[model samples]
Target: HSRGSRALNDGRDVVLMDADDFFISENLCSHISMHRDASEDGSKVKSTFFVKFYQKLHAEGWNLTLISRKPEKLRNATIEHLMAEGCGSWSSLIMRLDNQTQMDSQQLFLRQRTVLQKRGFKIIATISSQMEAIPVPC
Candidate 1:
């Protein structure tokens, strides 16, 4: 079994999706303007502004959850980068396993939504770059 699968089976929490689907940028403007080059791997990209935003959300009592398709090998690096970027901790780091590499963002979101809801979280909103994939209420 792959390290990614082993990590998922360890039982913290896992959300399935492709790695390319995730994105992070320095700021909202840059995020919108340079969406093509954004990378969610924190070790590769450092965003102080985004970190502050995440901290602000946490201060406001929002439980920030990171759902990514990153593998086990990158978990510590991602965590370290997040800490260096000023994020103290997060509510969860839901990752995708090796077998789940083919899952789409929508399915990932839905499954994790259900999991969070069952755990007594009231999801206020979902922020994603792929608007087409996520369902919206008319």
Candidate 2:
């Protein structure tokens, strides 16, 4: 909370981005989360800035909903990581567990896109970064 307050009070620009290597900098980011490894236990704390982002948002009446393709346990772990990383306590964040659905990335994206559109949300801008995994013959 103090960190975010400090950033805002200092007139720093708060940016938001997925947890990709491309967007990392010393700049103050308002929010950051893992994209490719969203479900991993260790990936939760791998933010672009710091956990104070969530704290600051909460202070400013921001309700953060964390959607995870991981199990309920891992989702909870992410929250834990947030707290440990400096968000203080993470009781304010909402966690949605998606493991039961077993949806792939494309399916999840389409479903979320439709739902968000129906909710009157529009995508203003999108920056795409592609990652591919190559098979190694044993």
Candidate 3:
């Protein structure tokens, strides 16, 4: 049986693999398309609406937090992109999905919300591309 099958069946086998192995190769057409979409230039253009919204929220004394499914390898790139889009203040609030946190977007959002609530911050709003990430009745 495959290691993955064994792990699933009995939880006894330990599988080791590099995180990079799961990412698409740079040469693949899909990877290229995704790279273009995530590029700094593309981000600057696509982020205009959100940037304006965030600026408005900031003006209204609301602190924004970013929760992303991006891997840790792209953390610096994410930060630089945020800074370029005039969101430097939010760089410190970025929460990225890394290898250790193997939770879905909804779980991650709930975890982050709990943590933030403990810090005395009332989470009045959440902006997410994925509707599943936002709990109903929130």
Candidate 4:
């Protein structure tokens, strides 16, 4: 429904992210984790949460035009085939779950995201909290 009410706080635009998966922090773009082995806990983490969120959008008549640094042009059928063949990377396997512009670089991703914003997609930029968090003594 509401992309969690947004506000023009400080200089950058921010929005409250969907609960259960996303983690919004000072940085606007940061989800990639060093612990590659960590599980999403079935969408408990940020990236998986965003992917699931977008999947819902796809079902709701939203035409997604993703602009990724790593651009792959293939149909869902191909992805399925790859999975069936058991030959796919973690990134490829994950990206196959939806139709999105999967990129590698933040700059490129942001550039494309800006263009999409101009084109009108109603997208929000959210990052995980701990990524850029200033640890306060507990």
Candidate 5:
């Protein structure tokens, strides 16, 4: 995120793409297509940006309903259990896992991240940086 700060606040005409948008715009589908069969065994699932993303959402009051194409991968139950353990509203969101991405080559074709607002919701961005196969809920 720090990489674009200089041009961002310079007062010149500037626009920013979230990690996801930059990936699609660059035609680097393979970069984003590498996590389709990620497992929770610690091999496929490596790390998750959900914490960071969640922090962003928490501050913005943006509720999330993740849409993962792999229904079996939904950890909503664990999230609900964690909520029962007192993780708060963030836990309920775990109960709402609602969508999934299509798969190919055991890797995800694409993972879409969107932002929700009172009036509507929109794809805020996409990311192709699969530096490590992060396990979900990491």
Candidate 6:
């Protein structure tokens, strides 16, 4: 199946997500809204959409990995929200600390991910993006 493709599956594929993009966004127009200042309707709509999306994916055998800056807190909240939305069987979700090194090594760390997969879950270190000292927009 293609990356981010909507192809149906027997349930078991994994979906990789960037926390800032997939789970939360700053602007109401954005697909994901996790920003504290986001409007209630926007946030609720996005969150419900994702909850249902994940439920369908999970039911179809798809796993999800959430890369986030908030660590355990974010993961717990996400699970709680999903459960509250009637999605209670989600398991094997991979949540980790969002750091520049991990982001930079996203592709490069595939080999490590292979190894880490054996452990079920792991939290990697994180740091701010340097990007040649250019300030990244918040």
- Please name the candidate that would achieve the greatest lDDT relative to the true structure: 1
Note the residue pairs that clash in candidate 4: 21-46, 23-127, 23-128, 24-127, 66-101, 68-102, 68-103, 69-103, 70-103
TM-score per candidate: 0.58, 0.38, 0.58, 0.31, 0.31, 0.43
**Minimal lDDT window, size 10, model 1:** 1-10
Candidate 4 per-residue lDDT, tens place, 106-129, comes to: 434444445545754444443222
Candidate ordering by TM-score (highest first): 3, 1, 6, 2, 4, 5
**lDDT, candidate 1, at 123:** 57
- Candidate 6's TM-score reads 0.43
Which stretches in model 5 have alpha-carbon errors above 4 Å? 2-49, 72-75, 81-120, 127-138
Candidate 4: residue 95 Cα off by (Å)? 11
Q: What stretches of model 4 exceed 4 Å from their correct place? A: 1-44, 71-104, 114-138
- What lDDT does the true structure give each of the candidates? 0.52, 0.37, 0.48, 0.35, 0.31, 0.45
Candidate 2, superposed: residue stretches over 4 Å from native: 1-50, 88-101, 109-138
On TM-score, the stronger of 4 and 6 is 6
lDDT score of model 4?
0.35
Q: lDDT at 7 for candidate 2? A: 26
Which candidate do you rate higher for TM-score, 1 or 6? Answer: 1
How many clashes in candidate 6? 7
The alpha-carbon root-mean-square deviation between model 2 and the true structure, to one decimal in Å, is 12.2
> Which residue pairs clash in candidate 6?
11-60, 11-61, 12-61, 12-62, 25-32, 99-126, 99-127
lDDT of 2 by residue, 1-138 (tens): 234432233222222212222123222232353344433433334443334455565476432333333345544455555554555432222223455356554444445444544655442222222221111234
Clash count, candidate 2: 0
Q: Give the candidate order by descending lDDT.
A: 1, 3, 6, 2, 4, 5
Better of 1 and 2 by TM-score: 1
Which residue pairs clash within candidate 1? none
Candidate 4's displacement at residue 62, Å, is 2.2
Report residue 133 deviation for candidate 4 (angstroms): 18
Indicate the residue-level lDDT of 56 in model 4: 55
| Model 6 lDDT tens row, 1-91 | 2235453343334454333323334432343434455465565566666666656665555455544433444666756644555665643
Higher-lDDT candidate among 1 and 5? 1
